[model samples]
Target: MQLRSALVTGAGRRIGREIAIALAQGGADVVLHAHTSSGDETRRAVQQHGRRAWVIRGDLSSRRNVQRIAREALEKTGKIDILINNAAVFFPTPISALTAQEWHTFRQTNISAPFFLSVLIGRQMYQQGQGKIIFLGDWSGRRPSRNFLPYCVSKAGVSALTQALAKAFAPHVQVNEVAPGPVLLPEDYGPEQQEELRTRTPLQRFGSPYDIARTVRFLVESGDFVTGASYVVDGGWLAQGHDGSGTSL
Candidate 1:
């Protein structure tokens, strides 16, 4: 199916921003959402590609907001050909100090939000009889992270959700996942930590947001027969059997 429009969440910066722009370059109008940030720049970039760009600012953690996301996106562009469930909150939640609030936050943002978005949007795609849904998961999801207990559990749920949704929306909506690692360093990551992480990866290098963006494009633009797969773009980190599974440097 030709991609006429895409809804990208958390697209104010980093991977989400790149994905939004890449989709625009691929000739799809974009609707970008962010919880606390502005997607004005991303919208401008998408608009620069001669495609319409709509910005929606709301917290995915809110069920009301999640319910309205696909509705607003479809209202803007009339149809949503690509649904990128990319909004997630990542943090370290050691089992020892894991709090109920922290776990709630992780599950709400990382799991529930995406699930709601997919159900609402997937039904639309099914009705149209053609569409693609790409969930942004985590590399730690495949291999559990020692320091990110809640996050790992949440992301693992996403992996399962991908497979379940793929089956539920079969023959119409192709559901897949992109699990990225070391794509962008955190603001608090130090140089020593960065170097250590770089050496641990089999690729000996971190990934760029565009790297993930390219992967997302391939999933939407091609891969018609592919679904229920979690594609990890982690510089071979997981394959190397590396002990560094935490989402930080």
Candidate 2:
């Protein structure tokens, strides 16, 4: 089935951009959300697929801003058939350096924003009788890297949120998550670190953004019986189990 319309957070670049474009390609008009970066590139990409596109800019860190984004998207599109919670902040927070402000930042942006957006839009979808919500999670959320404690914890909240929302919106709107692993390394990651992660993957390679986008497309376009499930697109890394290398995701 072709998706009517979708709101993709952080659609300005990386995996979010790819997901937006892929949804457009699959015949879904897209609502592109961007905060720090312009959504023009993704909007253009969506338009190239001959689907309608709208750019909504706002900071996900603020609940009011998130509410505004939902309101604006619904007003513009009439209704959103798909919602992709892909916007998040990732940074290393060493044990000794961790701060309350850091935890709050991660909680607000990574979890709180998505939670608000999900319930607000999710209720609408529930009332309408059909919709799909997909959250972009991290493999580290399951097997955390000690280096990014807050990030992992917030994402783990996402996993629980998915299950709760699925039950809340049950039998009407479908809710799920897609956890990606090593698809896009942080810009600050040095060559040795990058190589360590790449070689450690069971697939012996990194995944492309499209790998994640495609899984999202499946949940929206094809997975009618699927919900409350977390699909990990990590090149079999999760399956490898602890290789005793003490490798942290």
User: Which candidate comes out best when scored by lDDT?
Assistant: 2
Give the whole-model CA lDDT for all candidates, comma-separated. Answer: 0.88, 0.91
Instruction: Give a tens-digit lDDT track for model 2, residues 23-46.
Output: 998999999999988899999999
Worst 10 residues of 2 by lDDT: 240-249
Residues 1-249, model 1: lDDT tens digits: 677888999999889999999999999999999878888999899999999999998988889988888788888888888999998887667779889999899989989998998898889889999999999998878777788778888988999999999999998999999999888987788988888888888898999999999999999999899999999999997797654655352
- Local error of candidate 1 at 218, Å? 0.4
Give the clashing residue pairs of candidate 1, or none: none
